[model samples]
Target: MAVNLQKGQKISLEKEAGGALSRVTMGLGWDVAKSGGFFGFGAKSQAVDLDASVVMFDESNRPVDVVWFRQLKSRDGSITHTGDNRTGAGDGDDEQIVVDLRTVPESVRSLVFTVNSFTGQNFSTVQNAFCRLFDTSNGKEIARYDLSVQGSHTAQIMAKLYRHNGEWKMHAIGENGSGRTFDDLMPLIVPHL
Candidate 1:
């Protein structure tokens, strides 16, 4: 079952129902640049610095491992080195992060994504951020969340996983700011885990 997510929502997964074989996949998406321009026309283009990551945590919310991390660019969704921006500047663009839960420790109960920088001088205003969970067993989407509610800012976006009764649950959070490190994101996400 694919979880349909809206902005400012959260879900959790329970182990009692799915057992150890349960796997979850999370995806983040956003429009990097706007057609009108960055903060409007005649302004410096902002490039998404594109630092994406997934941190696995146990029930206790302790750091487990980094499941996936990358800096992305306009590559037609291909996983290759398109490039990186020291400053957040550019036209409208799309960037994403993909995480496969199977590779991480089974104890992991949640995942979080943080934007390190908008590198390009113009692209710093993030339009959207989101995460989704997929059922690896059937290759179906279990749940999804859209984080576009917090428009035009840099911050940490988080998704939580835990079991409620016998089903998995997830929670989506959008933290706003720039220069905030990944470590700063943990506290906002830990409560949901």
Candidate 2:
């Protein structure tokens, strides 16, 4: 079953499985604010100073994995202060999260992805956020969740994996607040599990 996530919550993916997941993939997508106008008018704006990441934790909720940790750049080479569109404008800003679930400690139980303002003061708003979990054994999407804007500049989204009645389950969590770095996300993550 899929879990309903509120803004600013984290869900553990490996709670009662008795071991770590074999493989996991996570993806996030969002719309950037348009540029050249006072209210998203005129020219299309880019999210230049955006930072996205996915962190994995053990059953004990310890740090285990990190992915997509960097500042985004424009792929088309258009330098008008607009942000980079990696997959073209039509696809939106999409990032992937892949984790070798087998490598995660058996004590760990979940994974988290926190989006933030990377350029200090630029691109502080999160227009939209979505996440999907995939099973590596067969490259299948097991579950998905759409993040709701909680009026915060940053958000800590979580996905938990566990076994229920002989079937695996994923729970998604959406937490709000400004968490630009991994250290900032730790505090918000520990208590959620």
Candidate 3:
């Protein structure tokens, strides 16, 4: 069964399966809202070039690696980005990051998921935005967090997957921010990390 996560909610990766979640994938999806043009005329909805990324941080919160459009795979081969999605017109995941949890280096303690509008289109024009975690082995959705809240922000700090006392857990953040890329979101992300 899939769990709908509320902001700040944290859940174990193992669920009731009695075994560790060895491989998981984070999926992000969104669509641009059709806008009524000037003077109440219909204008074609613009495509939102939203990008999903993961930043790996060490124990002290120092960034160790990043998996994004430009860098599809982590140096150690634990994290891999499927590919870039120019348009969010698909039925399923528009962007996905797969992680071999057990293969992650011991030095890397946490992973942060972020989504940004590279075209600078604010969330107010985006609809049906969501982030989800799935067990790759079974293709079962483990947890999902809605990122479709109405706001003027251009990006969001979606969630965090981290190691806690020998177990992997996920925390829903759903915090909005103004950023076109991960670099622009660093300041806002620091306070939360």
Give stretches of model 2 more than 4 Å off.
Answer: 1-22, 35-41, 64-93, 120-124, 136-139, 148-150, 162-168
Off by over 4 Å in 1: 1-3, 12-23, 35-44, 68-104, 118-124, 135-139, 150-152, 163-167, 177-180
lDDT of 1 by residue, 16-76 (tens): 2244434544445555545465567664434455555556566787876653334342122
Model 2 earns a TM-score of 0.61
Residue 77 in model 3: shift from native, Å? Answer: 0.7
**Residue-level lDDT tens digits of model 3 in 121-163:** 8998888989999989988889999999988999999999988
TM values, all candidates: 0.59, 0.61, 0.94
Q: In candidate 2, what are the lDDT values of residues 39-111, reduced to their tens digit?
A: 6557655553444565556556677555444433212211011232242134633655555544444444554
lDDT of each model, Cα atoms only?
0.49, 0.50, 0.90
After aligning candidate 2 to the native by TM-score, how far in Å is the CA of 71 from where it should be?
13
Q: Judge candidate 1 at residue 180 and give its lDDT.
A: 41
Against the correct fold, how does model 1 do in TM-score?
0.59
Question: Clash number for every model?
Answer: 45, 22, 0
Q: After superposition, how far is residue 184 of candidate 3 from its true place, in Å?
A: 1.2
In Å, residue 40's CA in model 2 sits off its true spot by 6.7
Ranking by lDDT: 3, 2, 1
